[model samples]
Target: MKNKFLLLTWLLAVPLLWGGCDKPLFKTDEASIAQPDELPPITTTGEGTFACKINGVNWQRCGGGFLQSSIIGEWHPVYKIFSLQGLRSCEGFDDAVYINAFIDSIGLYPLEAGQYDDFNLECQDVLDQYFLLETADNWVEILNLNTDEFIVSGTFQCTLVHEGCGDTLFITDGRFDYDWAN
Candidate 1:
């Protein structure tokens, strides 16, 4: 009899317990804004040295100081028949940068010549796709590789197209030194 009474009491309270809250079940407000971080999804893998310069004096890479790790690695842009981005097959002084993927579907080789390419196209493809250079493209130089390898003292060139302004080619043809990460 006690168990039956207890069961009866529990059953009767369930409806009363859930009755008060009736705020249209659930809803989302599209107009109400969210945080900047909540606005658009920021890429996790979309990290790398995205450097740019209008003239050549002020050069900047992505990640700045806080997010610099993404851009710190041995990377080079190459042009095969089909064009392929290649990463250094050999590991750099720093082991943190891993060659996850290469950019080209087939390896880097001329369709007619069939000559072997130096760097692996697979690695370069991944970098190009991840770090897309949609603006007027230019030869990308491998500035520094870890603490040891650095580019030969030369200023690389780049092309830029400001949104409203047209296109501009930047020439760093002179010579420049690279400062490797300590």
Candidate 2:
């Protein structure tokens, strides 16, 4: 009888001894960046929308209260190429994407990773972590090229594997609109 009463008391007292968790705790593996539904639209007016999803997570280029974000590009008429880069800066991430042009037409081009000096799509996330094009599908297609205004607009998608690491990043719905200088 006494043991039964002691067990009941212990169970009742244990509930009171435990503290409450008012704050939310997240694990390192589960700590993913916040995602927003509204991404910048695809435009040819140099809106500079450098955004994509990383492993199904949102990645955007913006002035993250600290570092500034911008898009810089150039087109060489004689070389028949247009190159552009997206510099992204956000809280806890400084990402960048690069696309080097080869053809001067508004068409789809092969952008394979790990290849040397042709049409390529490359990205860097969290430093030393690069997008590998050899793993999955990757390409870039120019939708609009306004030579008069020097605006280059394109859409790109790639499956990037981490160099030296086994992690993968899916860069999807990627688009860019930048005013290039010759």
Candidate 3:
């Protein structure tokens, strides 16, 4: 008698407890407007963030899956080269910006090709347009680099000249924080 009573109570109570709700438990505002792009917070503790404004529009890295990186940084001790690359792709459009600084110390480097060190910004835009660094008016600054942790943080702004047409690409408010070891 006791087992039968408990079984009946369990079945009756379970249905009433689970099926009593007539409305959703959580609500998301369907009429809510999308927010504008905001830059990620600058960090140096291996947050793997990279962002910049291209032609006054905000952009950030995206691609993430097996053995891939949206933001990556590396420092070669032998050659003393620092490399950083960021990639974003969506809606059949793609963009990439990268820098290879051949400097031994942390500082600002002009966007120029010189005998000792080379600093260049190679940007590929949405229409597969090619832009290369030309003039020295643009620059990149190495703000902080933690060699022990493989984290690098920096700021950059550059003007790249188009290859096909004689146009210019302005990259501003650029910042990156990456940990290659992670």
Candidate 4:
């Protein structure tokens, strides 16, 4: 009777221990970036949508916005700024991408519509915070930029170098259309 009880206890505990040891399905590799070749090509139709390929995997923004900020205190009338951001999600993970553009005389900020050798594009993910300004290998192009209607659109391709792990994420076919609130 005692031996049977011990055997039954071991059987139940073994499965529980094994199940608790399960690892995450999406793992970040230190030596190489994660690449998913099966993802479909990003849409480039400019239909007021945002999509991008991050590390070769499809990432689409569920929501995004354009915001403005102004320097207060002594510089109240001297400085006003605008910023654009998008949030991309995959497998419960969210990546936030941001762009800060140059402000105009009329307090309107729009992305520069042209190929840029360097820019201030930034991205933050679970693994790392990546930046385009760290290396000269990254580039961005603004296909369309309009501030009159409070809309800004663009396409970009960049190699975001991780700040902590030294890993790299290749972002390609990146496009966005941000409509700011009045």
* Model 4 TM: 0.54
Q: Name every residue pair that clashes in candidate 3.
A: none
Candidate 2 has a TM-score of: 0.66
lDDT (Cα, tens digit) per residue for candidate 2, span 81-138 = 6666666555444456666657577999766332111111233234454555664767
TM-scores, each model vs. reference: 0.23, 0.66, 0.64, 0.54
Query: For residues 52-93, could you state the per-residue lDDT of candidate 4 as single tens digits?
Result: 666666655443342221111111113434444555443333
What's the best-to-worst order under TM-score? 2, 3, 4, 1
lDDT of each: 0.28, 0.63, 0.63, 0.47
Q: Enumerate residue pairs that collide in model 4.
A: none
For model 4, state the Cα shift of residue 159 in Å: 1.9
Instruction: List runs of model 1 lying over 4 Å from the truth.
Output: 1-53, 60-64, 68-137, 140-155, 167-182
lDDT score for candidate 2 against the true structure: 0.63
Candidate 4: minimum summed lDDT over ten consecutive residues — where? 68-77
lDDT (tens digit, per residue) of candidate 3 on 47-128:
7787787778676765465234366557887887777777654322244677667655678876432111011122333454
State in Å the error of residue 46, model 2. Answer: 2.0
Worst 10 residues of 2 by lDDT: 114-123
Please count the clashing residue pairs in each candidate, in the order shown: 9, 0, 0, 0
